[model samples]
Target: MLKLIVNNLKERKIGLHELNSEELTEALHYAVANQDFALQREIGNHFTHIYDQTDEIPYWFKSEYDDDVTIINFGQRDKVVDWSSVTLEDCLPLTHSKHKPLLNGFKNWLLAVSDPLENGGAVIKTSTVKMRVEKVLSLIDAILLRSAALQLSLYHLSHITCDFWLSLFKAMSENGPINGVYDFTGRTVELVKAHVKSITQEQVNAFASKYPFVIRDIAEDDLTLHLAKQERVKACCWLYSQGYYKYGSSFIATGNGAVLAILLFEGKIASPSLNTPTSTELWLTEKERSTEYRPFNTENSKTSTAEATINTYISMAKLINTNIFKDNASSPSIEATKALSVRKINDLVILKPAGRTQTLHPDVVFKLTRQSFEFVLKFQQDILDA
Candidate 1:
């Protein structure tokens, strides 16, 4: 077992400092005999026993793979991850069952990396792990879709080159063979490709050995954040551009418009009043109850949702610049509220004002809220250009 552990460590390029072979061997034997490997207590309790004593070691004798292990946690450091509960068996049954041993070994790798006792490394927030997992799942779905189109299974593409991953991302960004249209900018695509290329050959070998490691790489990639940001901006743009609120973007630049947008955006004033004119407004009121905000990472607020919201806000700001300043035809309109907030005229989104319920076309409402609408169309371009 010691030989096996040492060989595994060497294969993974994980090095230990200060501890001699005898001490390291003794520690593993103690952990194996005394700790519950099933519960993954080896990392937490055993490492603490070895390293936590002040006279034993002043600093952690970590391997180059320490940060990589933390990164592989997918940002969920606080909560223990149950591989059984989060397995890909249901989605990729053929490969998953065939690769169970490899999967088990990789699970050991994951456990060894994230020591909650902080002997090995620091744990990250649970939310980040969840979000990364979600994003990776979506990307895998897209990849599988693309694979099916090519008449291939994931197993068939084992040990593929980074170029393969880059092409997959490119296809996803361009709305090519992928299921959904991503419409990511060329720069975003390039950046994503660069991220894919950044994976070391040794890291790729580690991932290729275990199917879940492939999934882990997908989750760990920078593309996950970019995808998260894009989706957020698109959702925000859709909500505002469709006239789901009391007032459109014409009022967005003003005090009242800002108040309305803020109220809706912040989930403060959730719905249209009982007297609101349109069914669309009523529908929006219901949707707002379940609305989620994801912002970019801020110095003070680095939570997953806050970071997503920040990214969306930045993308929206870029969109606003395009809509209000770059367009030659439409000047910024400062008008706030109409007599009636919103209504559906045939297929048009209608806004009526004080005098005689004067109607504006849905195009006019969309134009007034063009910044939000344009965000959906040009977010990636704006992000890269900025």
Candidate 2:
């Protein structure tokens, strides 16, 4: 039994027998502080028998002994008592009203049993029982610390649902400290964060309606878009940043007046993509015949139709220039009135648009590329010149 106990403690990195007298005493002090009366009583009994018989106490005792005691008792009178029969309540100091005795009789009893000079009229050598007692005491100390760690793990688990907490508790109890319970908790938290709950199409439509520029040209069939692994990770991080955990989607607004409706999808998806067109492209395409793409109320501007069209072209050019050279140091200046010039290049019209002060890089703004702006402008110009 002692060999088994030593092996168990060694497995946990607790070198009980190897500790010096001072270190062993300190370890015993820690165990006493934790109020593990059951282990204390077991250790006390083992050493008491060793001292009483004047026999050498082995490092480990093989047989088990029944020394169970209830931790509750009240209004006990001071009298001659058998230390062996003393309950946990008898050892505890009277810090509360229920406990009548102010003195810790159990601690006194343990000291007397382990001390060679004090053991009841027994001529037992201190050296004979000291090592055995220290080993047992050290084991008790380790058990107390493990028990506290288990309680702390349970406390953290309490934050989750009761069912989950119970399930985790059972798992820990069965195969505990094998893979750290705390590590298991961290993994559980990550799993919860990655859990993407599905939302109805109605919810998706409502979100799209609120941010038309962000959710532009989303195909009817593509309403249920699945997220890629990288996208899912980003979505999870974004959701956490927003102080939300339930919703697996968000409408990320960009600098260039565009909103991106990001949604997280469950399970693996093959070639997952956001099949949505830009609002600017769609707007430019629809107003190809109009002099200016923007609705020009005659009341809002005194500029002529031709001037408005030129101004609109300039604005589109600036937008495109902004997308292309947004990160470049020596980008061209964007004009407010008109594009620098529009020239025909084979089947395509090359608009020499100036760069804007406020550029929209593709990385900064989701899906707003230089090519997108160029495509819209070229298409619009072709229809107008036709």
lDDT of each: 0.32, 0.31
| Residue range with the least summed lDDT across 10 consecutive positions in model 2 | 263-272
Whole-model lDDT, candidate 2? 0.31
TM-scores of the candidates are 0.24, 0.14
Estimate the Cα RMSD of every predicted model relative to the unseen true structure: 27.1, 32.2
TM-score of 2: 0.14
Over the stretch 1-386, how does candidate 2's per-residue lDDT look in tens digits?
Answer: 44444344436555455656765455456548867564454345444544343233222222221122212111232112121321122332122222221112222222333344343435445454443333222222222223333331222111222233233323332333211122323332344345434433454455445434433454543332234333333333443343333223543232111122122111111111212222222121122445545542223111112322333322222222221222311122233212232221111222223443333444745554666777788798787788
Instruction: Name the runs in model 2 displaced over 4 angstroms.
Output: 1-170, 173-180, 183-187, 190-232, 235-386
Candidate 2 residue pairs that clash: 2-60, 214-259
lDDT of 1: 0.32
